[model samples]
Target: MKLKFSEGVFECIENPPQFFASLGNLHDATIISVARTAPGGVCFIIGDVFNNFVDFPEYPGEFGAAIILAGSTDCEWTVSASHLFGKKINDFEVFPAHSADAKYRLEIACHAMDRYVMNFDKAEIRIAR
Candidate 1:
C-alpha cells in the first residue's frame, strides 16, 4: 500500500515486511503486531527488532527502525519508540491524523501510526528512529 502523510510518501510491503519512506531505499522493518498494553491502551509497535531478530545498522542500508504512535478511544494520541537513536524513545504527546473511535480496529491503528511516523521520519533515512 502507498500511504501519503503530509508531504511524505511511504510504500508499505507485507512481503519481507518493510516500509519504504522516500529515503531512496527500503527499510527492513517490522510492524509490531497490535496488542493491548493496558486497559483501553491498544497499541502497535514498529522497530528494527522483529520476530526475535534484531536489525543491525548497515552503511548504505535502509532504515531499520521507526517511531510509533497511537490514538486513545477518546481521540487523544501518543508517540513512542523502541529505538530512536539520539531522540527520546519514551512516550510523548501527539495528535492523530484523524479522529479515533471506540472500535479500536487494527487497520485504523496501523494507518494512524503510519501517517504520524512517515511525517516524523521524513528527514531520517536508514537510521533507527
Candidate 2:
C-alpha cells in the first residue's frame, strides 16, 4: 500500500522488508513507526495511539482501535477519526479534531502510515477513498 500526505509526501513500500526499513528510519528519527502485522494487515504506533487497519467487511466501522483502512487492495486507502483508541495502555482520550491538544494528533498518526495529515472531521479522514 501507498500513503499520501497533505504536505505532498507520498510513499509506497511493496514488501515487508521495505516497510521495515522505512519504519526503522521513522522510529530512529522519532517520526513515526508502523508495522505490518504478522498475522495480516498493518498497525501504526504513536505515544498512546495504536491504530490497526482491518478490512472493512470484518468491521464495518470503528468500534475501537480496529478501523477500516482500505476497501480493497486496489481501493482507496482511508482512515476514520472515530477508530483511534488508547485504552489498551490506559490512555483513553480518543483522537479528536477540535481539541487544542489533538488538532494535529491525527496528522501525527498518519505519519506512522507514511502519510501526512490533512484537515477532516470525526468518523472520516481527508484522504480520498
Candidate 3:
C-alpha cells in the first residue's frame, strides 16, 4: 500500500506535450494507468497505484502507452487498458503477462497559441505563375 512517486513523472507536466522518455524513468513501472482529463486532454497514474487498491477492486494497464513520433523530434503518447484494467485488477497468474506495461495513444492538442502546429501543414496552392 506504499507507492512512492519517482522523480521522472514531473516531466509529464513540466515538458508540456512531450513524453517522459525511458521506461526506467517510471521505476520500471509495469502499468501506465489512464484517466480522461476534464479538458479533453489525458492524465496518467503511473506504477503500482493499484497494488494498494486492487483488493477494494478499483483503479487501472498496458498493452502500453504508444509513442506517436512527430517528424523527427516531437513525440506524443497514448494509453490503452484492458476491460479488466480498472476492475479485476492484475492479470491472472495463470496467464502470461498481458497488461502491466508502458504504452499509449496520440492526441495532438493544438491550443489557441500553437501557431506553428496549427499551420504546419497548410499550403497555398497556385497554378504555375
Candidate 4:
C-alpha cells in the first residue's frame, strides 16, 4: 500500500528484518513514522497488524488483528485488513495546515484478535522544523 504525505518529505520500509523474521502470510504489517517538515506539521508513530481467515464448519472469512501507535493528537483513523496486509511500511515527513504545537493523537483499532502486539524497538517517530 501507498501512504500519502502532505508535503514533499516521506519515506518507507517494508518488513524490516530487525523487527520481523519474515513477512510470510502476515504481509499487512506496517510501521509508519511521521516527522514534521514545516512548523505546522506533527510527527507520530503507528504500528499495525491484520489477519483474515476461515474456520472449518464454523466461520468463514473471519478476521482479527491489532493496531498501536503514539503521538500527540486525538483524531481517529480507520484500518482495514486489505490495507494492513497489502501495504508496505511507510515513513514520512508532513506539513499540515495547522501549527506544530497543535494537539495530536494516535488511535489503533484491534480487530478479531483479543489484543494487538507492537515491538516499539523497531519503530519510532521524529519531528524537525
Best model number under lDDT: 1
**Stretches of candidate 3 above 4 Å error?**
1-12, 16-19, 22-27, 48-80, 83-129
**lDDT for every model?**
0.29, 0.27, 0.25, 0.29
Which runs of model 2 end up more than 4 angstroms from their true locations?
1-31, 48-72, 75-129
Q: Model 4, poorest ten-residue lDDT window?
A: 120-129
Candidate 2: minimum summed lDDT over ten consecutive residues — where?
66-75
TM-score per candidate, chains pooled: 0.24, 0.19, 0.25, 0.21
| Candidates sorted by lDDT, best first | 1, 4, 2, 3
lDDT score, candidate 4: 0.29
Clashing pairs in 1: 63-126, 83-129, 84-129
Model 2 lDDT per residue over 1-129, tens place: 333222122233223223333323222222123344332333444331112333323322221212112211211234442333221221112233454422212233333353334322222112222
Better of 1 and 4 by lDDT: 1
Per residue, candidate 3 scores C-alpha lDDT tens digits across 24-77 of 222233333444433233333333423333344332322233221211112222
Better of 1 and 3 by TM-score: 3
What ranges in model 4 sit over 4 Å off?
1-71, 80-87, 97-129
The digit string of per-residue lDDT tens for model 4 on 1-129 reads 211212223333222332222222233333344343232333333333222112223322212222222233433235433343333432222222143543222223333331222222122222112
Greater lDDT among 3 and 4 belongs to: 4
Clashes of each: 3, 0, 11, 9
Q: Candidates 2 and 4: which is better by lDDT? A: 4
lDDT of 1 by residue, 8-103 (tens): 222322211123213212233445443443333434444432212224332333224432323334332344433221231222222222433422
